[model samples]
Target: MTHSSVPAPSPDQESLFAAAAADYARYRPGVPEAAVRLLADVLRGRPDPVLLDLGTGTGQVPLALRHAVPGLAHIEAVDVSRQMLDRARDALAPVLGRCTLTLVHAAADEYRPPAPQPGEVVRQPDLITCCRSYHWMPGPAVLAMADRVAAPGAAVAIMGDGSLWSHDSEWTRALRELIQAYLGSERRAGTHATYTEPRRSYQEDLATSAFTDVSEYRYPVARTWTPAAVVGYLRSTSFAHPDLFQERHEAFEAEARQLLDTYTRDALQEEAVFTVLLARRPGTAS
Candidate 1:
């Protein structure tokens, strides 16, 4: 990553993540280790691969990959929220001595790693990951940027899964309705922004970008959530962020707890399916 040129995100977009950083760092589930292995395969020939993780909220990608991928020599993690970066720094502290870590407090679009210093040798990143945070980025523009900063065989992975509010299970359906009763039917995100579904999928976006070899993988996961855990998870998300409830925050939590308890008494856990979308330069060994 180079520091010379990068685009900035709108203030509204930047502030949307302001309040939830702590919750996000505390409660957002990690990317599965299996996913890290796939990422490692994409960078097979690079002896000391560099990683550039965009929208790297709480540094989850590196934290998950550090132990799984042995040759990762450096990681440049970027995020919009300073608070999120703060938490990420704390989480990454133990690994600092082993890996060259750079934490950038800028929106995904506006971040660029500094040029290598004198006596330093730097290569374009072998893997660029934007997990669960690609939706916040400027789609094709970010891909174009990746094409510039990535190595010839490097891969760019854009990943996420539908959240609790979007799950279709009976209990989840009821949970959605409960959330809507308080926050209305439209999905809200980051402060005042409402989610507007992208017109194209990440596959389509990558197909048209410079990194044209696109592939996707899905992982089915089962999660057991205590009522307290569920509440904490909701606080981490943009749609059900705590501030949305305003004066009704406590009431909403109480009702949400009761609703989850009633559902769990019959079925002990919730299950979800997660997907990972990987795009690479043509001819890369995947």
Candidate 2:
């Protein structure tokens, strides 16, 4: 709530999200409450914990945690997309309580929080989070940055719940096929590229970093989406973003809504496993 340093994001074209930021702000789901409680539990024992969130699209994680974590001194939310950062700042400002919030417009690996203000207690981030965004970064460099700046024994938590595009359900399958018919067989990424599966797992990447010890947590997540919300969610995604559909986005959305209506009278459901990989230095305990 107090400070900012100004600059998605992909591994390229940070402005790719500029056009869709409004949709993203309106339609993108916040992290499940379970994730919030889990993190609150993680920091409950620390004297005063600070959190750094990388690739913080719309600042959902930080915004959710703003009032939950006890003695949480500060939050640094870093993202490459200016528009997403704008949405984040707006969303977080109203709810931010005792904790200091910093919105940084920069890449994860390149960002550093400001020096503590005069009369502010010294602080270093004790928890670093990358929610639904680790895959879009230079994993090694970002991990290295976390190692350099995070407090000793600090934890790095990486969170992801699979996208609707990958869910296995009648409506989702139909939607995928519909997207392929318009955009082609491969999933789109950013502006002019396709999404490629990661060659190595996140665990493997963490094992090689300074925060080498890792543990995983899974929370069952169920979401219901209205046809209109689905269309808005698609607009916020890189794969189904309006830009990817060329001139056909409006037509595609119309068809998608109709297709969704055929599947359900009101809502489409998705069951997902929200996975958190909590990493720490050797012998460190959360």
* True-structure RMSD, every candidate: 2.3, 2.2
The top-ranked prediction according to lDDT is: 2
Error of 2 at 92 (Å): 1.2
**Per-residue lDDT tens digits of candidate 1, residues 1-286?**
2222244555676577778888888778888767877887776667888889998888888887777776778888887776777777788778756677887766766666577799888657889999988887889988988888888788889988778877778877888888889988998875577889888888888889988887889988787777788889899888898888899989999999999898777663667767888887888745
What is candidate 2's lDDT per residue for 125-217, written digit by digit as tens? Answer: 889999988988889988998998988879999999979889999899999999999988999986778999888889988988998888899
Whole-model alpha-carbon lDDT for candidate 1? 0.80
| Regions more than 4 Å wrong, model 1 | 1-9
The whole-model C-alpha lDDT of candidate 2 against the native structure comes to 0.84
